[model samples]
Every structure is written in structure tokens, then in C-alpha cells.
Target: MCKAVFFKKLKYRRDVLGDVIVNKHKCLYCGTCVAVCPMDAIELIDKWVEINEDCNDCSVCAKICPVGALGGVK
Candidate 1:
């Protein structure tokens, strides 16, 4: 209960701190982001890149993305 509440309250920080945002329409689905992510936070599912909480705003994926679809909010 307490932990849940804490997580819920801090959930927004997940994005501000380091969460990676993927723009599906612009994604090339070339698997570059997945391969370049140092934290393995980016995953190529079906035809899109998915960003998990494992990201640390390293920007590796963003820099490596050929289509400029990945962004980290550090």
C-alpha cells in the first residue's frame, strides 16, 4: 500500500528523470535503437521501439536513432 502510493506519486518523475520516449510514426524499425541502448531500455516489438524504466537518460539510443524517434529527458 505505502510502496504503491509512493510509486504512483513518483511515477511522473520517471519521465522527467530518464524515461525514453519513442515516436512510433517516425520510427524506422531498423533495430538501431535496440542495439545502441546501453541499458537495453529500448526494445523492438513488432515494428516499434519500446522504452522501459531501465533507461537512465544516457541518450545513446537517441543519438543512434536514424529516424530521430527516441528521446531521453535527462
Candidate 2:
């Protein structure tokens, strides 16, 4: 059986300014961020959540993360 690992295939990409940062460890793969993203920037691929470049750093995804796994780092 294959288990999901943190940061697997997910690149450490952040916006130039204060953008959304995903804490892989804290993420529950609940898809909350993906559903709440107004720009449709966050995606759940396999088991990893990917934030695409279309992200506008509005912090909507970060705000919706239930586990506090997403945030903005400035």
C-alpha cells in the first residue's frame, strides 16, 4: 500500500511578496483551500495541494485552511 508523504512533488514556491504558504505537515488534504480559492489557484493532485502561478496572493486559501496549514509569509 502506498502512503502519502509531505511535500512530495510539491515545489516550495511562494509569491514574491507575502503569499500563501502551505504547511505540508499540518495539511489534512481536506480540499478546503482548493474549494475556497477565488482564483482557482490551489489544486489537490494525488495527495499534494499545489498552488499555481495564477494565485493572486489574496490569502483566501490561507484563510480557509481548517488546520491552519495555509498562511502568508512575508
Candidate 3:
């Protein structure tokens, strides 16, 4: 039998800024960010995707974004 490797729960800093930043004007109503986010923080609303409470600020979504819609503030 194979034993599963248990991992500790991920604890992220609340004040940390995510690397993804959405440009409202440049956005094309694509769901790329929503699909790429591991934490499921982004959601599509009225054809536009928006970040929700589930955001862990990991920046995975930003890195995968093809159009550079999501990026860090700094």
C-alpha cells in the first residue's frame, strides 16, 4: 500500500500583495485568470472576471495570464 504524503495547510500573509493586477480597460472578458488561479479567487461576472475573497495572493494567475492582464501593483 502506498502512503500519502500529508502536507501542512498553506498559511499566506494577509498583507502581501498579489503579483496579478487586472487592467479593466484592456481585459477582453477572458476567463484565463479564473482558470489559472489555484485558490479560486477570481470569478467571472457579467462577462468580466473579478477577484473574490478566496484570493491567497499567490500570483499564479498573474504568471499564467497570456495578455498580461494580471500583474503586480509595484
Task: Residues 1-74, candidate 3: write the lDDT tens digits.
Answer: 23332221112222234434577776776787788778888888996777766776777777777777776534
lDDT of each: 0.78, 0.77, 0.66
Question: Each model's TM-score, in the order given?
Answer: 0.71, 0.73, 0.63
Steric clashes per prediction: 0, 0, 4
Worst lDDT run of 10 residues, candidate 3, spans 6-15
For model 2 the local lDDT of residue 43 reads 91
Candidates by lDDT, descending order: 1, 2, 3
Task: Point out the higher-scoring one by TM-score: 1 or 2.
Answer: 2
Model with the higher lDDT, candidate 1 or 3: 1
Candidate 1 residues lying further than 4 Å off, grouped into runs, are 1-13, 16-18
Per-residue error (Å), model 1, residue 39: 1.0
Model 3 residue 24 lDDT score = 76
Expressed as tens digits, the lDDT of each residue in 1-74 for candidate 1 is: 69989887676567666677777788889998788778887777887667777877888888888889877566
Comparing 2 and 3 on lDDT, the stronger one? 2
lDDT of 3: 0.66
Q: How accurate locally is residue 31 in candidate 1, as Cα lDDT from 0 to 100?
A: 93
